[model samples]
Target chain A: MDLVKVQLTNSEFLSTGIEKLDNLLEGGILKGFTTLILGSPGSSIEILSKQLAVKGKVLYVTTDETEQEVMDAITRFGWKPEHIEFTDIATKYSKSVLSREKKRVSIYEQRSKLKLKELIEIGSSGVMPAVKAQEDFLAIFSNSAKTTSPEKIILNSLDFFLSMYSQEEVLRTLHAAKVANIERAGVLFIIMTKGIHGEVFERKMEGMADCVLELNVIQKGSTFERFLAVKKMRNYAKKIGIARYAIDSDGFVLEMIERIM
Target chain B: MTNSESYVYNQNRIGLNENENAKSSCPCITGIDELDQKLGGGLPSGNTVLLVGSSGSGKTTLSMQFLTNGAKIGERGVFFTITEPLFKLTKNLEKFDFYDKKMIESGMVNLIDLRIISERLGLDAEKYTVEDASALLEILKDIADELDVKRLIIDSITALCYRLQTKEMIRDFIFKLGSSLASMNCTTILTSEVPPNEVKYSQYGIEEFIADGIIFLGDVDRKGDLIRTLQVIKMRGTNHSRTKSAMSISSKNGIELTPLLKSRV
Candidate 1:
C-alpha cells in the first residue's frame, strides 16, 4: 500500500525546544517523518530526546530505562510526566520474561484461574510468546494512536529492541511504525546508539529512517565535547556542520566549541 | 599432578579452606588464584587497585578477566572505557572464554565509553581542571548506583592522564576516583600504560600513591624468548607476596599467572 505523506507547514514542524537545534533543523523536525537519533555511549542523546518530548504530544516507548527513571528524567528537565505517556517495554520484559515466578507459571494455567469472561476479554495469558509479544508491543502504539493521537512518538534506543528480537522482526515492526507515522501525519523518533551494532544492521535501519541525526562525544583534553550532525534528512537542506552542546542542571546548552565541518 | 591442575589446587587452598580459616581479609577474587594469592587473599574489598603496563601489555585482558569472573557469581560489573570504545572492547573481549555476551545482555556487565566525553571537552594538554574530573566522577557514580556494580574497571587511567596531562589533574582524578570507589564499597581496577622499561609502577608516579594497591605487568626476556610477568608491588591492609610471577594471556583461560616467587626480602 502507498503510504500517505503529510504536507507540513513551517508552523507544523515539531520543535526540539533547543532553539539552536530547531534553527538548524529548518524551524523544527518535519511532521510525519521517521527520524533516527544515533549516538554512542555518553553522547547525551537521552537528554536531547527528552527535551524534544516537551515539544509535542509524545508517546515515549522506553526499552532501556525504567518508568521511574524516565519520570525522573522528565521531571529533571522541568517537564511534567502528564505531557508524555510511556510504553515501558524494558520493565515489562524483565518482569515477564526474566522473573522466575512468571516463567514457572504457564499462561494457559493462569487463564484457568481466571473466569471465562475475563479470559475472553483479556486473553488467557500470563506471559506472551516472543512473536506474540512483538505483535502486541507494536499494537499498543497503534491502538493508542486511535484514541490519544499523539503528535510525536519516541522509541528510546532501538539497540535493546534489536538485542531482544531478530533483525527481520524488528525491521518489520519498524516498517509498521513508519506506515503508522505517515497515516497519522505524526512523527516517529527512533533512538539508536551507534557502534552497538554491525555496519550492515545500522545501514539497513538507516535506510528505513526519513532523517538520521548522529550525536558524538569526543575527548579533547580533560573535557568532553559533544557534537550533533544531521547525517540524513529527506527534502530538507542539510546543515553544514555539527552543533556543539553540553548537559547541565538547566538542560542541553549549546557550547561555544568550534563546529567540526 | 599436571601444572594447570597443580595451579588450580594451589589457588583453591585459600578458597577450599575459607570455612576453616576465617580469613580477616575476605577479599573478592580476580578469579585467577595465583594472582589473588600474590595480593594476599584477592584484592581487599572496596579498594582501588591500579594495573599499570605498556600498550598491548595485556592490561585490558587482565581487567576484563577480573570483571568477567565477578560476573560469573552474579556479582555485577561496570567497565568505564576511556581509551577504547565499548564496541571495540566488547568485540575484543569476545575472543576470550571468560567473555560472556549474556552478562552484558542481562546488564550484569555494563560498558560505558567516556572517551568521547573527554574528547568533546577538549581535555588534551596537562591542565588542572577539577570541573572535568567532577563531571566524570558524577557520571561514574550514576552508573555505579544504577547498576549496583561491585566490580569496576577503568581500562587505562592512562588515557585520563593523557587528557588531563598535568600531574596535578591526574593526581586529583585518581584521588577522587579512589575515594569514591571506597565509599561505594566497590572493588575497582584502574589500568594505565607506562613505558616498557619504566621502573615506576604508574605513568605519573602519583597513581601508586593514590591507589590501594598496584599490579605491574611487563615483559621479561627468558632465554631469548620474551615472556610477560606480573608482580604485586604493594597492597595496603594485608600481608601479600611481593614477588614477580610469570603472566600469560590465553584465549581459553584469559589471564594466567604463575604462583608467586619466593619473597626475596
Candidate 2:
C-alpha cells in the first residue's frame, strides 16, 4: 500500500492586527508560542485581544464575560465576529452555581420532611452524600482547546481561574495548554490583570510565556493615556519596545513603537 | 409496519411470553440458547455481573445481545455507554441482525451516553471525587427507576472508574450501585476491560470482589487464528458450567457460542 504523507503549512508568525506592531517584531508574534497580555483596568486589552481574532479561526475562552457580551464588544468596534468560537466559562460557571444551589435547597427540603429515625440515620453518616465539588473549569478549557483545535486561542483572563482554583493547579493547566499550542503550531493569548496575582506569580507566568505584552493605562490630569509595551519577546531582544495606543472608532490603533535599544 | 407495530411483531416472533425461563423467579434468561443452557437458565435476577474482557473479544456484542434479548421478553433495558458516543455505538450495532433500531426508538432498550449525563450534572472534573461518585450513583438510580429498567449495562466500567480515583471509591461506588439497583430488581452488567494476558478480571481489582457474578471474555491464538472465548468465572444463585466456550460474532446471528476444540499447537 502506498502511503500518503500530509504536511501542515503553518506560517512562522501571526499578526497582532496592528501593522506598526507587526513591523517592529519583523512579522508579528511567533507561531506555536504563548503570548501573555497583562493589562490594568481600563487599558483596553479586551479590544486588543478581540482584534487578534481576525487572523484565523479563534477559540475565545471567556472566563470574564459571557459570549454574547464579548461578541457585542467585538462588533461595536466594527470587528467581524465570524471565525470565533467561544467556550463561555462565565455562563457555565453561573449555571453550575445555580444548579448547585437548587440541589442544596432540594436536599434541605427533603431533610426537613424526614422522620426522626431517618434523620438520625442521616446524622450518623455525618455529611450528605453526592455533594460533588465545583466542576473543574480548567479541564473544560483544556477539552475545548483540544476539540476545537483553533489556529488562534484566546483566554480572556487568568484571574478568575486563579481565584477559583489553587496556584499549582492553574500553573499545571497553563503548562499543558502551552505545550498543546506548541504541538499544533497555534498562537495562545492569555489575558490577566496586572499586579493582582503578586510579583512572584506574575514573574512565573512571564517565564512560561514566549511573548509578553503589557497594556498600561496612566492618569494624566483628568484624562487617561493607554500604552502598549512589548515587554518580552523570546529570541528577539531588539524587538522589545513600547507604543502609545488608543481604542478609536475602528479599533485598537497603535501610534508608534519606540524601540528599546 | 409502523415502528411500534414492527417492534411488537419482532418481540412476538422472538416468542416473548412463551419463554418460561424469563418468567422464572430466580434467573433472568439471556436469549442466547447455548449460553443460557450453560447457565442452567440465565444470569441471576437483581445481581451485578461484571462482564470482564479484553478489546475486540465480543464483550460489547454479548452485552448488547443480553439487553436486546431482555427487551424482547418485555424486560426494559438501558445501556449507559461511557467511552463511545451513542451514534457511533448504534451505527456499529446496526450490523447485527439481533439489533433492532425499533427497540431503541420504542424505548424498550435505552441508549444513554454517560458523558452527556456528566455534562448535564455539571461534572466537568478530570477525576471524580467521592461525592461525585455518589452523585453519579444517585443519577444512575434515578434513571433506572424512571425507566423501570429491569436490565442495566454500563459498557466498560473501566472508563467510568478512570475518573473515580481510588480503589476504595470504586468499591464503594460499585457496592452502593449494586445494592440500589438490586433493590429495584434491576440486573446489571458492568463491562470491564483488562489486558489480554492479565489474570485479573477488572482494572481496579475491586470490581470483581464487589460484583455478584463474573463473565470473562478473551481471545486465544490457536493455529494462527484468534478465536474469541467466553467463560463463566462465577454466577450467584445458579449452577453454571465453568468451562470456556469458543465464541463467534457475525452480522447474521450476533453472538454464537460453541464448545472450545482442543488445539494441538
Candidate 3:
C-alpha cells in the first residue's frame, strides 16, 4: 500500500534567528525536512536547537551528553521557559534495540491481577486470549514512538548507540527513526553528528532535507570565532560557506556582505 | 553595645506576622532534644533560619539534619547552596543516610542550583553589610515565595556581613533578614560566626531583636578537650531555658545538645 504524500510546493522554513542566512535558504528550512548540524564539542548547535525548541513541544534525542548538561547549555540562551517542558527518554530503554525489559515486572503484576476464569472465558469465546489486554499494555509502555505533530524535534547525537551496536545497525534504525520523525510527523528534525564521514552524512541529510546548516568554531589569535554555512535550500540560493560572525551573552551574530548582482 | 549598659529595643516592628499560621503542620523532629525545645517544637513552620559558620563548622550538617528530620516525618525540604559546587555537595552528604533518598525523586526534598547566579557575578567583591542586606533578604523572600518553603537555614550571615564593615549596617541586615523571614511566616535560623574569643552575641544587635529567638553555638576547651556547646540565649514569646549546653558532633548524629549546662558562670 502506498503512503499518501501531501507535498506543499512552496515549502517554508525558519533559519531560526539568522536573517540573511534564512534568505539564502528560501524563507526558512521547510518543516518536516530533516537537516543535519555538524559542529565541535563547544558548538552551539544544542543552543540553536533549544532556542527553536522552547516555543513548541520538542522531543530531544541525545546520546553524547547527559540530559541536565544539555538543559544547562540551553538555559544560558535567555529563552522564556514557561511553555517548555522536559523529559528524559534516554533511560529505561535498551539502546541496542527497541526492547524494554522493565515492563516485565509490571506485566507480571497485571497478569497476577487476572484470574483463571477470565482467561478461560475469552479462550472459550474463540476470542484471542489476552490480545486486547496485551495491546493495552503495549500502548501504555510505548511512549517514545508517539509522534506529536506540530512540534520541533532535536536529535543531539547519533553517537549514543555507538557503545551498544555496530555502526551499520545504529545508522539503519536511527535513519529510519529520523525519516519517520520527519515524513510521518510534522516537525523540524534537527539531527546532529560529528566525525569522519560528516560530509557524506551531510550530503545524505541534504537529500532528505530542505536546508542544511554547518557550524564551525575556529581559533584566531587571542580569541575564539564561529562560522555558519547554509549548504543547500531546495527553492533558494541559500548562503554558502563560512561567514564572519560575533557572539555575546545572548548568542551567535552573523554578517554577510555578499554579491548583490 | 555593652551587655549590661546596652539593651535592644524594637522599633517600627515593620516585619512579623500575627503568626496565625504559627506552628502549622511542622511535623519535623530535629533529632536534638534541646534545640527542638528551644525552637518551640522544631522551628515554627514557614520560618527561615540563616546558619553562619566557616568551612567545616557543621553548617551543611545542621541544614541536612533539619531536612533529614523533615524527610523522616514526610515533610518536604529544599536546600539551595551557592558556596560550593554541586558534585562536592552530593559527595559530602552521601554519608548521611537519614537524608531520605526518595525525597529528591518525589520533590519532597529538592536542591536548587544558585551557582548560576553566583558564578555570573563580576569580581572585586562588594561589602555585605546591613545596608545591602536587603538585596540578599529579597533573594530569600523570592525563594520562599517560589518554593513555598516551610523551614529554611542560611548557613552564614557572616558571609553576608563580610562585605559590610559597620556594626549598625550588620544589625540592619540582620533585622530586615529576620523580619522578612517572619513575614513569610517561616521558622528561620541565620547562622553567623563570632570569633571564639569574642563575646557570645550575634554580630548585629538586630539578630536578637528582630528574631523570635537566638541560639549561640561555640567550642569550649574543657581540660584540653575541645567540647562543642550550644546555648539558647533568648526565645521571645516563649519560656525557653537559658542554658549553655554541652554539644557533640558525630557522623551519624549531626549535633547532639546535652542539657547539662545548669552550672552557670
Q: Which candidate leads in DockQ? A: 2
**Model 1 chain A, poorest ten-residue lDDT window?**
A120-129
Please identify model 1 stretches exceeding 4 Å from their true place: A1-261, B1-25, B117-128, B259-265
lDDT of 3: 0.53
Candidates in order, interface RMSD in Å: 21.6, 14.1, 26.5
**Residues A155-222, candidate 2, lDDT per residue (tens digit)?**
98898899988988999999999999999999999999998999999999999999999999999999
Q: Stretches of candidate 2 above 4 Å error?
A: A1-261, B1-24
Q: Taking the tens digit of each residue's C-alpha lDDT, what string does model 3 give over B1-265?
A: 5654332221111112213224254323465666765554555544434443344656677777777676666655656554555456666777775555577657566564333322111111344434234444454555555556556665455655565577777667667666775666656666666566455455554455555656666666666766666666665544445666687767676677776544333
Cα displacement (Å) at residue B181, model 1 = 1.3
User: How many steric overlaps are in each model, in order?
Assistant: 23, 0, 33
Q: How far is B206's C-alpha from truth in model 2 (Å)?
A: 0.4
Share of true Cα-Cα contacts across chains kept by each model: 0.00, 0.00, 0.00
| Candidate 1 residue lDDT tens string, B1-265 | 8999998886676555443324443577888978776765578878899998888989999988889888898889877776665667877999999898888778787776655433323332244266656656655665575568888988778767766757788888888877887777788899978888777787777888889888889877756766788988887776677778888789999899885444333
True contacts kept of 3: 0.00
Highest lDDT model number: 2
DockQ of 1: 0.01
Q: Judged by DockQ cut-offs, is candidate 2 incorrect, acceptable, medium or high?
A: incorrect
How displaced is residue A235 in candidate 3, in Å? 81
Fraction of real interface contacts that model 1 preserves: 0.00
* Models sorted by TM-score, best on top: 2, 1, 3
